[model samples]
Target: MARPKNQEQRRQALIAAALDSAGSKGLRSLSLADVAKRAGLTRGAVLYYYEDLDALLVEAHKAGIQRFCDRRDTLVQSLDSPGDQLAAAIRAGLPSGPDDALMRLLYEFDVLAGQSAVHDELVEAMYTRQLAIYTSVLEAGTASGDFAPVLDIETLAMNLVALEDAYGLHIVAGNSHITVDKAEQAMRAASTGLGAPPTPDGGETPPA
Candidate 1:
C-alpha cells in the first residue's frame, strides 16, 4: 500500500495540482476533478483539504502571488544600481510567455474582478502589493541620487504596474508578436519617461 500524506503535504499537493490544472486547462475550465486527477488523488481527498472549488482557487491565486513577489525580491537583491533594479523589477514582473501558468491564472482572476467580491478583494490587494514593490525601488533610487529627483514616485509606480498588467494580458492572450523582449522594451521606455538613467545596454536610456 502507498504511504499516506500528512495534512500539510496533502494541502500542498492539492494546491500544486490546482496550478497544474489551471496551467493546462485554463483557469476558467479548472474543476475539482481535474485538480484531483493531476494530483493523483481522488475527489474526496481534494475535498478533505479544500471545502470547495472556490477555496482551492483562492489558495492557488495566493500561491502565485507569493511566488512572483519572492522572485522579484530575490532578483532585486543581487543588483546594486537603481536603474538596474528598476529594469530587473520590470523583467521579473512580466510573464515568461503565453505558457506561463502563474501569469495566466492571475489574469484569469483579473477578468472575473467585478463578479466576485472575494476576487475583487484579492485583485485589489495584489495591485497594492505590486505598486509597493515599484514604489520602494523608485524611492530608493531617488534618495540615492541614482534617479532624477523631478519625478513623481507614486504616479510612476502606478503607471509601471498598469503597464505590466496590460502587457501581461496581451502576452497571455497569445499575441504572437508580443514577446517578453518587446514587453520589456516597452517597460524600459516607460521607465526612461519617468527620468531614470540609461542602463548600460542601448535599450534603457533615461528621459532627459
Candidate 2:
C-alpha cells in the first residue's frame, strides 16, 4: 500500500489530478471518478478532500488561476522598481509554453458556465476572482507610475489580458505571430507611450 498523505498533500494531489483530467477531457465530460482514478486514490478519498464534484472543480479552477497569480504576487512583492515590477506582471501573464492546458480548462468552464445551471456559480466565481486580481495589479501599477498615467487601469488591464488570450490562441493554432519577448517589448512601449519625453542619458538607474 502507498504511504498515506497529509491533508494538504492529499488536497494538492486531488487538485492536480482534476486539472490534468480537465486538461485532457475538458470540463464538459469530466467526472469525479476519473479524477480519483488519475490521482491513484479511491472516490471516497477524493470526496474526503472535496465536499462534492462541483467543489472539486472549484478547487481545480482555483489551483489553475493560483499558478499565474502566485507568480504575479511573487514578482510584485520582490521588486522595488516600478518599471521592473510592471515588466514582471507582463511576463507573468504570458503563456509559459504552447500547451496552455490549464488555460483551456478555464476556457472550457467559461463556455459551459452559462449553459449549465449546476456549474454556473463555480465558473462565475472563477472569472470574478481572476478579473479582480488582474484589475488590482493594473491599478497598483498605475498608482506607482509603472504604467502610463493616461490609460484607464480597468480597461487597460482587461485589454492586456485579452491580448494575452489572443496570442495564446495563436500559439494553439500553430501560428506564432508574436513571441513572448516581442509581446513584452510591445507592451512596454505601449505602456511608456511615444509621447512620454525621452529620458536623458543616465536618467534611469538599474535596480540595486
Candidate 3:
C-alpha cells in the first residue's frame, strides 16, 4: 500500500539522518531531536518509524555494517589473486578517516555493547560478520597457495579485526597522524607477516 511505501521511505530517511548526526556529533551524543532535525522531520514522525532512540540506533548500526560489507564485496569482486583480495579487504574495512560516520557509529555501538541484551547481540553479530570476511579470504589464499599454510585462520582473522578496530578508533578520536594510508600500510605489513606475498610497490594497489 501507499502507506507502507511511505513508511519505508521515511524509515530509510531517518536512518540516513541518524548516521549523519552520529558522524558529526558521535553516537554518544546522538538524540532523537538531532536525527529528526537532520531528516527534516518532527520527533513524532521519527517515533512513528522507530519505537525509540535505541531502536533507531540498532537499525542504524545494522545499516552501517551492511554498507561496509557491500563496499568490501564490491572492491574484491574483480580481483583474482587472494593476496590482492586480502589487501583490498583490509583497505575496505578501515574507515576513510576520523570523519567516517559509519565507522564512528560502529564504535559507538561497540562501547555500548554490554549495556543491554540488544546492544550485546548486535555487537557480537557485527564482529562475527567481520571476522567471517577475513576468515574467508585467508582460507581462500591458503587454498590457492597464495598465502602460507595458516594453521589457525580464526586467530589470524581475529587479529586483523582487532587491529582494524583499534586503528579506526584512534583515527576517529582525532589522531591526525594516524591517517587511513598509514593504517592500510600497517595492515599490509601485518598481512605479509602472516605469510601473504609482499608487494614490491609497498602494497599500494589501485584504489578500491
Candidate 4:
C-alpha cells in the first residue's frame, strides 16, 4: 500500500512538474528531460511511472483539464442561483494570477501543439469541457428565470469560454493590464451585457 501510494504521489509530482515546465519551455519544446529535472527525478524514474514522454504528457493534459474545467463545473453546480453560478464560474475560470503555471500551460497547449496530434486532441477535449461549463450554467440560469439571454445560449456559452481563454492567456502572459480581478470584472460585465447578469447576491467572491 505504501509503495502504491508513493507511486501515485510521484506521478502527480511529475504532472505538476510538466505543467510548470510547459510554462517555461512551451509545449512544443517540452521534453522528458525538462520534466524530470523539474521534478528532481531521474529520467529512468519518470519512465518507471509512465510508458514514455507522450504518456506522461497525456496524463499532464488530463490533470490540467480536471483542475481548470472539472473543478469549475463542480463549483458552478454547488451554487443554487444562476447569477451566483455564473459569477462563481467566471471567478473560478480565470488564472489565479500572472504566475498561474497551470492556466499558462493550458493556453500553450492550444498554441504550441506543433506536430503532436495528441496535443491537439487534448486541447480540443479541454475546450469542449470549457464550453460545456458555460452552457450548462447559462441554461440553468435561463430555466430558472435568471437570464434573458440576448444572444442564443450556445453562442453566449462559446463567447464566455472564449473570454475566459483570452483573458487567461493575457493574465498568464503577465499582461500587467489584465489582472485576475480586472478579468473577472470584465467577464461579469460581459455577462450582464449579454443578458445573464448575476442577481444582487450572486456577484460575491467565489470559493477559492
Better of 2 and 4 by TM-score: 4
Local accuracy by lDDT, each model? 0.83, 0.66, 0.81, 0.85
TM-score of each: 0.90, 0.70, 0.90, 0.85
> What are the RMSD figures for all models against the true structure?
3.5, 5.1, 2.8, 3.6
- Deviation of model 4 at 26, angstroms: 4.6
Which rank order by lDDT, best down to worst?
Answer: 4, 1, 3, 2
Shift in Å, residue 195, candidate 4: 1.2
Model 2 lDDT per residue over 33-100, tens place: 99999999899988877889888887787678777567667766686655555566666666655577
Regions more than 4 Å wrong, model 2: 1-8, 47-52, 116-147, 194-208
CA lDDT of 18 in candidate 4? Answer: 87
User: TM-score for model 4?
Assistant: 0.85
User: The CA-based lDDT of model 3 is what?
Assistant: 0.81
Encode model 3's per-residue lDDT on 1-208: one tens digit a residue: 3398888888888888988898888877779999999999899888877899989988898898888877787776667777777877887788887777788778887889779998898888888878988888888888888789444788888989999888888887779888888988898778777776534343345455
Model 4 scores worst on lDDT over the 10 consecutive residues at: 199-208
Candidate 1 residue-wise lDDT, 1-208, digit = tens: 2245577777888888888898889877888999999999899888887899989988888887887888888887777777778888888889999988888888887887897898888898889888988898889989998888356899889999999998998998899888898998898887887787537453244567
